[model samples]
Target: MQFHLSFPISPLVPGIQHNQQLMLMGSCFAEEVGAQLTDHRFNTIINPNGILFNPLSITRALTSYLDGKLYTESDLFQHQDIWHSWQHHSRFSGLSKEAVLQQINQSQTTAIKAVEKLDWLIITLGSAHAYTLKENSQIVGNCHKVPASNFDKRLLTVEEIVTSLDNVMHRLFFRNRKVNILYTVSPVRYVRDGVVENNLSKAILLQAVHHLVNKFNRLYYFPAYELVIDDLRDYRFYKEDLVHPNEQAIQYVWEHVTKYCISPDSQELIKEIAEIRKAAAHKPFNPESEKHILFLKRYEDKVRKLMILYPQIDFQPLLLSFIR
Candidate 1:
């Protein structure tokens, strides 16, 4: 008996290969999937500016990268002895203004090079609700624990979201015409905004994504939002907070991503990589046991073989770990 609805996602044509460069931006879901792709030895960069929830903030970050914009003291504000950028996440905040600018610019520098040759750009939009600073009406990517009284919050309209992202898409294509964009609405619910408001925000993002995807030939949509919400409709798939997906649910989504986005040959390679990774992580009952030593030698041989087969991947870490 079928216990859950399984919606088959359409495969992306010319599936992603191991050698191609990819970037994942927007919400925490991007981080989750990007980490998995990196583990499998795919060349990927995730959230160069940090986790951004709203589309406008995401677009602003991407625009900065395309321009290779450098942040200075004027762009930062000191709060409680720490410096923060309205355009960056709290991760970039630090006690020293110079140190903060250095961190932010370093990421920007890396992103400038990555985006130029990027093959796939995966975006996971989390919400349409945005917060803007009242002092300058500038959208803040991360509030950095700033008092709520200092900012005004509002739900972004569909037209506004579409227009902002449309401009970003154009800028991205101009930078790299070969870059293909894959859009997904994050399944993580923003319950703090109220359940209904979260749904409304997601609706706006979904509409905007489709609008842009339909307008552009290189754009595609992955039904991650539908897969989690409608297909696996259960509280069990969620963490205790009932907001983020549990590890099991994340794996389920990862499986779907592999099946739909990755090439068949690469999928087979991923399984081999997974086996090698599992063996590398194994901790036996007896460290000096001959059986364990044999296990390590076997995986060491596998890693060497894989390295020879895919010279692009760096298996040095796994190779060193297998060393006695």
Candidate 2:
């Protein structure tokens, strides 16, 4: 006698709702997606590790990149105002430049904590290769500094990637019973790496991540790399560097993501968001109302729209107090 067995295939859902909190991490590409979601009023918590500079700093850096002045350390440091604000924040009490540099030598504890609250984890693996610091033997996200002689780009094996992911997932599951994981490989070519080895490194990462996605039941892989290479292979979709995806490419990626990950209620919220965004885009700022009155009106308009869509979601009264 022969027996037939059946397995359940999970239904693919659309993009998450506006009310769902999202936590984004991994590479710089994830930062771009996080910023877009934030602009659409999604509750996006970026870079849980807090080692990287905050969102405002990222915006300033992107502007510098656009202006063709982001090629040097001096240019990057020109956006110090964003970091200065963090210094005054109570959470950063003991955080100094030296301390942060030292902390980078240790495993990322803050990133581990941030992943704990995430309903959906969006990780974009930039490279399988990483530079390890001499002092603490910890993996550095980017090798922007540290004498070239002291560092070597060590490419992680599939096992290493799986182990690292399992470690993070273990912590997350211990904190919360269930969590969904999404992985993507960044499509940006490492042009500055100055070696064929760079492309090989990305290929290895792509292969390894794909393997993990297939093996894991809960993890999902998004075709970000394919979308760039296959769907938007045209050079026009890229920035001046001919590497990073331009705004158009990013929009295309987001639309594809929305099709698979978003829910019905979230889709409705996004439609409302589009209307709000259009209204805000067309409205002129009235400067003469005794303390930036037009800003208040805009805030009120946004609040009204949010209330109309999510009347049950209670917003803090203090949230409105800041508008005036």
Predicted model with the maximum TM-score: 1
lDDT (tens digit, per residue) of candidate 1 on 1-324? 989788668899989999899999999989998999999999999999999999999999999888888888899999999999988889999998899999998998999988889999999999998999999899889899989999999999999988888898888899797999999999999999999999999999998999988999999999989988999989999999999988988999999999999999999999998988888888889989999999889989999999999999888987988999
The CA root-mean-square deviation of candidate 1, after full C-alpha superposition on the true structure, stands at: 1.0
Candidate 2 lDDT by residue in tens digits, 1-324? 734322232334534767666777656678888887776677776654332322222222222222333122221111222211221122222335444433422323443444446677677777666666566564444334335765655666767666656655555556656567777788777666655866776777777677777876667878787787777678898999987899998988887666667777776666666555554454345646554575657656676667776765543442363244
Worst 10 residues of 1 by lDDT: 1-10
Model 1, stretches more than 4 Å misplaced? none
- For each candidate, the alpha-carbon lDDT, in order, equals 0.92, 0.58
Model 1 residue 40 distance off true place after TM-score fit, in angstroms: 0.7
TM-scores for all predictions: 0.98, 0.69
List of clashing residue pairs for candidate 2 = 14-261, 14-262, 15-261, 15-262
How accurate locally is residue 280 in candidate 1, as Cα lDDT from 0 to 100? 80
* CA shift of 176, model 2, Å: 1.7
